[model samples]
Target: MKTLDFKPKLVSAIRNYNKQTFMADLMAGLIVGIVALPLAIAFGIASGVSPEKGIITAIVAGFAISALGGSKVQIGGPTGAFIVIVAGIINQYGIQGLTIATLMAGVFLIGFGLLRLGTIIKYIPYPIIVGFTSGIAVTIFTTQVKDLLGMQMDAVPSDFIEKWIAYFQNLTHIDPWSAGVGLVSVAIIASAPKFSKRIPGSLIAIIVMTVVVLLLKQYAGVTSIETIGDRFNISSQLPDAVVPELSWETIKGLVAPALTIAILGAIESLLSATVADGVIGDHHNSNTELIGQGVANIVSPIFGGIPATGAIARTMTNINNGGRTPIAGIVHAVVLLLIFLFLMPLAQYIPMACLAGVLVVVSYGMSGWRSFTALMHNPKSDITVLLLTFFLTIIFDLTVAIEVGIVCACLLFMKRMSETTDVKAVYDEIDLNEDADMERGNLEHLSIPKGVEVYEINGPYFFGAGNKFEDLMGGFGDRPKVRIIRMRKVPFIDSTGLHNLENMCLMSQKEGITVVLSGVNEKVEAVLRRNNFHKLLGQENICNHIDLALARANEIVG
Candidate 1:
């Protein structure tokens, strides 16, 4: 493994930086910043945080990621992925708890990078990713329903079923003005790409809805619609950095939640880097990317930010706008900083329902309904994992869903591997021509000696296949003077296999039979020698070929 590599992409990107590249980066960064603005505010409000916190993250974390990241065009900021978990932490343990958890997660991310576990992200099961992602999308949509329709209610319940019940109970209190703004915003967002691809539909929806709602509220006296200012006191300046109130007790309590954040952040950032690599035909150093994310998460929370990661949407926006370097990401941060400092109070005018409409669209895109439906036709085991994760995420939580889903997937994998392992008895005569492992010009046939039995094992001898081997050995008919066990096809042996082999050897000795192991590869022979298997079965009895084993077995039979 390589020692820690602290190199960031920005270091190399600057070597060839020129006026033309800067111009291109400037255009892309400006557009992406515009696209990121509404999303930051919406995610902040939805995550039970002040709206300015989102911009702070987009500015602070966004700058850290681009300045120290591995990917050239990856745009990092607050994303929808953490909404459920962040909200849950706040609800259960308040802002301080969330802070401690975020800090712990940052340290975990750095550890992951230093340990060089970044490549492991590729091993996460696709079904599980889709399952939880779709589940999160549904959860996000549920959370936005109240704001979308302007329902008059207290806090929305955290439980999925109870939250829906609350929505039903409060349906009678829907404000038509808010509902109209939300529906129109959704319509604009859903249809805007058809007319113009360059401009973001979310930005357009926010502008149009904010203007319409403002005009209606001031002149028409339709002042019932709620806006961001009504809920969160907007801040136009960055606050002093804060040290998280962390103790050993708090760290212990927050480990699991922190692990959830680390896992989600790693997956999202690496996935975004992978996608951008495909678009730009460049390979990203995954470990470097993880470290950048670790730094971002660590710094952002100090300035009143929430958990952040690579935003695939904004990264794509950057790519489409011709951003080919980290400079674009840095410029985007600067743009958000300007907005946060000078124009944050104007954010108060943006309607809550309009933000809800934007998130509704995000939830729909995240749903991955097409992938969900396609996966239904896969193997039943995969479908089982998929559905289990999806439901668990909805009914319980994302952390539970991921854990249970991985366990189920592993069990099913072992089951399938065990099924492929073959153990069977060979009778009468063996044909060398039919044996693929033997030389083609060797002995044509070998007759079995009277009262001798031969068995072949055709796969890895792991714990999963140990019981099958035992059953086959114990179920054989007739007493045998000699037994030859073929292990040419077995690639490796586990402790369970060694234990079973020992038991078989001891049982054979008591039955007045000589046991021989045939085609024992160098590795298995070393394992047997280490276990003193040769003392139980003589060293000469372990043969390299079936012919040699048959000769020894015939000598025993005679």
Candidate 2:
């Protein structure tokens, strides 16, 4: 393993910074900042926290991730992915507990980076990712139905089934004005891009709907709409940095939640970075990105921000708008800070129903329904993992769903690997005339010495296929003077497979029969060389092709 490098992409970007790049970054940053405002507020409200926490996350975490991260254009903040987890944590463990857990999660993320586990995390199965994401999208949509319909429910239940039950029970109390505003919000967001792509649809929807709600309440006597001002206090000032109180008991109890947060944060941030890399035609250092995320998480929560990670939508917005460096991300944070200072008061008028509309749109984009439906046509095992993860996330929680999904994927992978591996006799006669044009003449007419045999092992020789190799070799009935094992198709071998191969070699040596290995691929050859298995088999017995092995076998039995 190479020594870990802690360099941030910003350092390099700044060195090559030019006037043209600065202009692009500035405009992109401003646009993305505007795009992030409503989303940050909506994610916060949906996660059962005050709207300020989300904005704080966007400003503080977003800045840290960009300034110190490995990706040039990543925007970090509270995303919809964490809504379910954060809401559950806040409900079960109060704000204080959530703070402690988040802090611990930050420590875990830092550890993940220092330990160089970034590349490993990326290997997580795609089916599981899509499954949990779709599940979260469904859950987010479910939570918003009450607000969207403007149902008069005192408090929505956290349980998936019970929340819908409450919505249905309060269906008669739906406020038409609130629902109308929400519908208008969604419509504006959906259609605003056609008029202009420079401004985000969500922002337009929030602005138009807030004004409409205010006007209707004043003149038309429609007053059932709930705005941010009615729900939580909107503060223009930044929050003070404070550490949460910690104890051994609290730390022990929070370990699980903390790990859950760390894992999800790492996965989402790296995934977002990978997407950004594709857009910019650059490769990001995964380990360095994880370290940057760790630092952001650690610092953001000190200012009363919720758990934050790379926000995919906002990052894409930045990329599409010409953000090519970390400066763009830094500028985005600054823009949000300006909004918090000057425009916070106006935000109070933004309707809860409108925020709900924004979340509904977010959930729909995240649902990945097309991918989910397309996966239905995949193999049964993949479909099983996808559906199991999806249902488990909704019925239980993300932690359970992810754990089970990985386990299922692993087992299925092992089964498929074992099925692909095979050990069988090579009974076909070679045609010498067919390969006359080749450098190595065909050994089709080459006569096999008496009491000599050939066998082929195909696919990867891992623990899953080791037993098959042993069983097939053990099934040989008659004693042979020489046995050639053809490994042309075997690309790699794990420790167990190597051990089994060693056992076969030792048994053949004891039985006074020469074991010749043929057509060993580079990877398999490296393993054999590293383990000194070639010496044990006698270097003269190893061959590059079956013809050489046959020649060696004939010489041995001559």
- lDDT against the true structure, each candidate: 0.90, 0.88
Per-residue lDDT of model 2, residues 38-110, tens digit only: 9999998999999988999999999999998989999999999999889888888988888888888888888
| Superposed Cα deviation of residue 344, candidate 1 (Å) | 0.7
- Write one digit per residue (lDDT tens) for candidate 1, span 1-558: 566766799999999899999999999999999999999999998899999998898999999999998999999999998998899899888999988888888889888888888998768889999999999999999999999999989988889999999999999999999999999999999999998888899999999999998999889999899998888788797799999766899899888889999999999999999999999999988988999999998998988899999999999999999999999999999999998888889999999999999999999999999999999999999899999999998899888888898899889888888788788888888878766655546568878888888988899877656566567765557888998998888888878889988888888899998999988898988998999999989998998878888889988888
| TM-score per candidate, chains pooled | 0.95, 0.90
Where does candidate 2 stray beyond 4 Å?
428-442, 470-482, 502-516, 519-558
**Structure candidate 1, residue pairs in collision:** none
Q: What is the lDDT of residue 402 in candidate 2?
A: 85
